[model samples]
Each structure stands twice: as C-alpha cells, then as structure tokens.
Target chain A: MSTIPAELRFAESHEWARQEGDLIVVGISDHAQEALGDVVFVELPEVGKVFAAAGDQAGVVESVKAASDIYSPVAGEVVEVNEALADGPEALNEAPYDSWIFKVKPANAADLGKLLDAAGYKALIGE
Target chain B: MGQRTPLFDLHLALGAKLVDFGGWDMPLHYGSQVEEHHQVRRDCGIFDVSHMHVLDVSGSQAKPWLQHLLANDVGRLQQTGQALYSAMLDTHGGIVDDMIVYQTDEGYRLVVNAATGDKDLAWMNANLAGYDVRIKHRSELAMLAIQGPNARQKIGELVNQERTALIHTLRPFEGQQEGEWFIARTGYTGEDGLEIILPATEACAFFNDMVGAGISPIGLGARDTLRLEAGMNLYGQEIDEQVSPLTSNMAWTVAWMPEDRTFIGRAALEAERVRGITSKLVGLVLEERGVLRAHQVVRIAEVGEGEITSGSFSPTLSKSIALARVPMATADRAEVEIRGKWYPVRVVRPAFVRHGKALI
Candidate 1:
C-alpha cells in the first residue's frame, strides 16, 4: 500500500500537488514511482521558468527501465525545486509525498478543483 | 489471460513489479533495475526462468534425429551433460527459435521459450515422422538461474558439498543432476552461474531458501540489460524467422562442418556464407546524455543505415549502449539518431561491460 496524504491533490498521470498558500508544490505519486522502477536521474524545470497550463512540459525523469515526462498541472511560474533530487533521485521512489519537484504559482487558483481528490485518485487507480 | 510462472507468488511476496512480458506475468524489477543489474555483474542474483520450456527428446536415434532437425550438429556432443546452442530453422533457413540442447546419457534435453513450444514441437514431430526419437514437454518443471561471479559460491554454501561435488567438474555448456535438482553451468549471462531445473512443487521452497541465503531476486529488466552487456542475443529482437543467425552475430553457433550432416537450412546458410553477408551485428556506445532505445536509426558514415535491435543504459558503464545491425562494410564509428539528434558513437564488438567492470 502507498502512503497518501489527505491534503494533496493528484492527477490521473500520478502527480501530486499541495497548496502552499498561493504556491503549489508538485511531485510524482507513489504509484508513479512504483511503476517507473528505480529512478536514476531527474530533469527538473529551472527556477523562475514559466510554463503554460495545457501543454506545459515541465521536465523529465529517467528511470532505470524508461523515461517519463513531467507535465505541469496548471499554468505557473516555478519558484524553487527540490535540489536534493539531483544527487538523490531515488528519494522520489522512497518518499513521493515529501519530495516535491517544484513550487508553482497557479494561473487560476480555482483550477485546483479540477484535480482529483484522494477518493477520486484511488478510484482512478481501480483501488 | 496472463501466464504465471511457478514462482509467481514468491515474486509478489518480494514486492516485485509485475509486467506483461511476451504474454507472461513476469517481474520487471523487484525494486531497482539498476541495482539488480549491478548485483549480477558485481556479485550474485537469481532469476526465475521457469517460464522457459524444457523438453526431453530421447531414443536410440536421437543424435541423428537432432542433427537432421536443427541447424547445428548434435553429434559433436560426445560427452554426457555437454550442451549445444543452436537455432531451429524453417525450411527457408530462417530461424524459428534459438535453443540449448543438453546431451544426457539417455537422450537429449532442450530448453526453449514457452511461446514457441507448440510450433517447435510440431516442427520436430513433422521432421521426425520416421525417426525413433520421442519428444516430451516438461511443463511441470521450473527453472531458476542464479548468475554472477559469486553465484557458485553462494549456492555452494547452501547445498551439501556431496551434492555439488560433481558440479565443480562440470564445464561450460554442461550440467549434471544431484538428486531431484538438475544443475547446469550454462547461462544466458556471460558469467559463472547455475541453471537449476527442478519440480514445480519445490520451486517455492527453493526460491525462499535462496532469498534467505542473501540471493537477491531479480526480474526480467535486469535480465535483459545483463544479457545485452554480455553480448548475448535475445529472441525476437536479435534473431527470429524474419532474420538469420549469420546477420545476428550468431555465426559461431552454426555448425558448418560435416558437409553430409544434411541438417535443415544447411544449404541456404552455406550459400549465404558464400555470397557473403551484407549486414553484421555490432555494439554501439552512446556518446551523449540520452538513453539508447530499440528501433533507433543508426547511420554508419558513408556505409549504410542500421537499426538498433537492443539498447539500454549500462549500469556499469554509466552510459547508454546498444547492439545494432549495420552494413558489414561499416566503419568503427556510427551515429545514432535519438529524438532527431544524431550523436557520434563508437562501434565495437559486443560485451560493453562484464564482471562489474567496463570493457569499452
């Protein structure tokens, strides 16, 4: 079983987002980490990088088995990244909840309602 | 429906990530594929290869029968327990399946993939209509391959000395049985290890004992990477009915001697050899940041284009590498197109890394 926090919202692609006041903390879900196998390296979006909501390709993470793109959940300007991931990419595999990739300022604050909650995410995974 | 190996429950208990591989529910990785690859290269790891099919062909005329059926010679296996790797070819000389034949005192034992069981058996039966050989599929058996430099040492500690005494003298491509377990020195990974074939009911216990003995349970992801590093060819990817062994760097496995052997596809291979093979399989090491993936186009400067058959990031080399089939006239360097970017790479013989060290 995966450890899921109640406050964070999840996307169907298995990314989790938490509202930190006006900023949103984004990272991968436990299900995503388990599916990607062992993470070897991470390519995170640069600090202060602005991305559009619909087609935002924030960055990429290369796992031992395959590579996956990290999509932005909402339009935002990156403020900071989990620099610790550069040296310890497996931290995402170990703790997806706390290992947030970046912080973003949502373009539309109300867009958070579109993301899935704990129950919706669980149902999406056929749990 | 997904197929399951005898050790499927054990894999689940160990927290392996299961995936569909060739229609079988096999483990892709336990936790870390990179770590599993390193375990096999640096130390020891065990894989549940029970999904592979095991068959026994016996009778007085088994030798002559096999020589007539397979592309390789079986008479060359004069000693008991000696093994021979060969390709089962169609009448057109295209490979149907690649298999390992073990010479037992009573007859010959073969290990093939489960997917090719019906087709291979049908071919063997149709070819041996008048021969005295009998084929028996041992689907009730399970196989485990414990591979690495330290594999023998770990197994040696677990089993009784008296049981493994005969294993020490067993050479490469040879094996012997101790009680109910048949242990073979032959392995797909280019390292010292044992492939143990035992009854399916005992598979769970053996897996548990091995895991308890500190042998890490590896999945098919590392299996692919390890075999690629060892320069071994995988079925469907390297060679199949669509491709011949000659172009897949498996010419050595083909027996060309004993002109009168009259095996299947002998004449075609001979003609192919005489005509000269146009394409040859070679190894490539990526010089850039991206991972090497299959189906990528390879440009051999001034020579011709090739395609990557198998590619992955070598855990030991800390870079991407691949096996590509390029023109025989290709030079020592090539370029691989990854995501539209051509990266300069060195073309060399396979075996990019072995025994936990980089060989490039």
Candidate 2:
C-alpha cells in the first residue's frame, strides 16, 4: 500500500490534492508514483491553463517504462506550476504528495466532495 | 482472462505491480523499476521468465525438419548445448517469432514467448508432418534469468561448489542440468549471467532463495529497457508477422548458405535480398534534452521519414534513445520531432551499455 497522507484527497486516476485556502495543490498519489516507476520527464500544465473536472488529460508523465497521461480531478484554473520538476522529475517518485505538480483555484470548491478521501482511496485500491 | 506464471505468487509476495502483458498477468515492476534496471547493470538481478514458452523437438528427422522450417539453418548447431538464434517465418518471409534453439543430446529445444507459443507450435507441427520429428511444449518448467557481471560470482556463492564450477565454466548459450535445475549462461540483458530452468512447483522457493542471496527481483519494465539497450528487438514491436528479418535489422540471424537449402521463407528472403530492402532498423540517441518516444517522426533532409519503433530514457546514458525503422537512404544524423520541437539525433548501433559500462 502507498503511504497516503490523511490530509489529502485522491482522484481515481491517482492524482492527489490537498485543499489550501482558495488553491488546491495537486500531484500524483504515492501509488501512482510507484506505478510509474522512475519519472524522468513531466509535461506539466502551464500557468493560466484551464482544466475540466474528471478524466481530462491535463498533462503527461514519462517513466523509463512508458508514458502515461495525468488526468484532472476537478474543474479548476492553474494558478501555480512546480518548475522544479523540469530538472528533478524523480522528486515526484521520491515524495509524490509533496511534489506538487501544479496549484489550481477550483472553479467549484464543492467538487472536492466527489473526490476520495485518504481512507476512501485506500479502499478504492483495495488496500 | 489473464494467465499467470509459476512465480506469480512470488511476485505478489514481493509487492510487484501486476499488469496484463499479452494476456499474461505479469509484474511490471517490484516497487521501483529504475532500481531493478540498475541492479542488472551494476550488481546481480533475477527475472522470472517462466512466462516464456519452452518446447522440445526430437527424432531423427529433427535436423532436417528444423532446417526447412526456420529461417536460419539449424543444422549448423553441431555441438550439444550449442545455441542458435533464428526467426520462424511464414512463406512471405514475415517473422512469426524469434527464438533461441538449443541442441540437446535428444534433439533440439526452443524457448519462445508464451503468447506466440500456440501459433508457433501449430506452424511448426504443420510442416513436421512429413518429417519424423515430434514437438512437445514444456509448460511444467519455469525459467529464471539472473544477469549482470557479478551474476556468476553470486551464483557460485549460492549454489554448491561443484555446481558453481560447472556454472562458472558454462559457455554462453549453453545449459547443463544439476539435479532438477537447468542452468544456462544465456540472458537477454546483454550481460554475463545464467538462466535457470526448473520445475514449476519449485519456482517460488528458488526465487526466494535467489533473493535471499541478494539477487534483486526485476520485472517487465526493466526487462524491456535492458533488452532495448542491448539492441535486442521485442517480438511484437520490432518484428512481427508482417515484418521480415531484413527490415527488422535481424538479417544477421538469417543463414544464406548452401543455396539449395529451402527454409520456409527462403525464396521470399532471397528475392528481398536481390530486390534490395527499402527500410532498415537503426538506433537513435537524442542530442537534445527531450525524451524519445515511440511513433515519433524522424525527419531527414535527403532520406524519407522514419518512425521510432521503441524509445525511452536510457538510465545508463541518462539520455533519450530509440530504435527506429527508417529509409535505407537515411543519413547517420536526423532530427526527431517531439511536441512540435525538432531535436538533433544521431544514428548509432545499439548495445549502448554492456558489462556496466557505456559503450558510447
């Protein structure tokens, strides 16, 4: 089982987010990082990018194994991007929830209700 | 539905992330894939290759039958335990599968992929009707690949000294039996190592024993990268039923001797040789700071466009590399388009890293 923090919520696609004031800081889940093996490159969403809720292919993460798409968990506008990932993409693997791919100001803050809490996400993966 | 290997339980115990690969439920990685890849390159690593198919072909007509069935002349295997890598092809010279044929005292043994076993067996059986050879699939056996430069040393430390001596002196592509285990000094990682084949029931125990001996457990993720770095082609990606060995960069595997030798795809391959192949497979190293990926376009000034068959970030080189099928006229250097940006790349022969050292 992944070391998911209780303070964060997870999307079914494996993106993890934590609510902070008006912004929701998002990255991949611990399980997602482990599943991706070693992340070598990350194609993150640029600042000011608009995102739709659920299943929207927001970006891409390429590992030594294969490339996969990162999906959006909720409707939002990108407010901040983690530029550190450009050089140290493996940081996401080392510390997924803390890596923080991008911060988004949720268009509908209530959409967080649809996402899974740490306990619910653990059950979702049958952990 | 998905199938499982004999070591499926062992992989689960090790916390491997399971994935469906060609209908088989296989481990993509045991927690971390990069570490597994590095283990094979630096130290010793073990891979559960039980999902690969092993078949035995015997009888007096074995030599003659295999000679006609395979693209390479199997009769060239004179010494017992000598191995030959060849392509089983259709009449049109399309590769059915690439396999390693080992000459045993009884007859010949072939280790092929599990996914292609049925088709390969049926194809071989159809042609062996006239011959006296009998083909038998060995699903009861499990295979383990232990690779790296320190592999034999570690294996020597684990097994008894008597078996250790035998394994240490074993030539590449040669296998010898010690009790129920068959150890071969052959592997796909382009490193010095041994591939051990034993009874299915004993697979988990053997895997645990080897891991206890400090052999890292690797998965399909590292397996793919290791093979790619070694310039070894994947069956489905590099060569398939629609692609011939000529275009697949496996022409060296084809035997063109004794002009009279009539293998399954002999005529078509001979014609292709005479007519000249239009496309060729080559290795690409990205000169820029972008990852090379499959299906990316290769643009050349004089030569035509080519496509990347397999591409990834090479852990050994710390750069993006790929295997591409390009026009025969393509230059040694070309540009690869990645997300609207063209990056300079150089074409080089593979086996980029061997024996824990970068070759280029």
Top candidate by TM-score = 2
Worst 10 residues of 2 chain B by lDDT: B350-359
lDDT: worst 10-residue window of model 1 chain B: B162-171
- B1-360: candidate 2 lDDT, tens digit per residue: 599998887789998988888889998998778788898999979998888998989998999898999888887888777888999999999999999988888898899986898899888877877799888888999999999989999888877777898897899889877777778899998899998888999888878988998788999889988888888889888889998999988888899897888999999988998999999888999866668988999987788899888999888888888999999887879999987778899998755777777776
Can you give the DockQ of every candidate in the order shown?
A: 0.47, 0.61
lDDT of 1 at A72: 79
Residue A16's lDDT within candidate 1 is 87
Lowest summed lDDT across 10 adjacent residues in model 1 chain A is found at A51-60
Ten contiguous residues minimizing lDDT sum, candidate 2 chain A: A50-59
The CAPRI-style docking tier of model 1 reads acceptable
Q: Assess candidate 1 and give its TM-score to the true structure.
A: 0.92
Question: Across residues B320-339, which tens digit of lDDT does each residue of candidate 1 receive?
Answer: 88999999998988999975
Tell me how candidate 1 scores on lDDT: 0.86
Candidate 1: what's its TM-score on chain B?
0.97
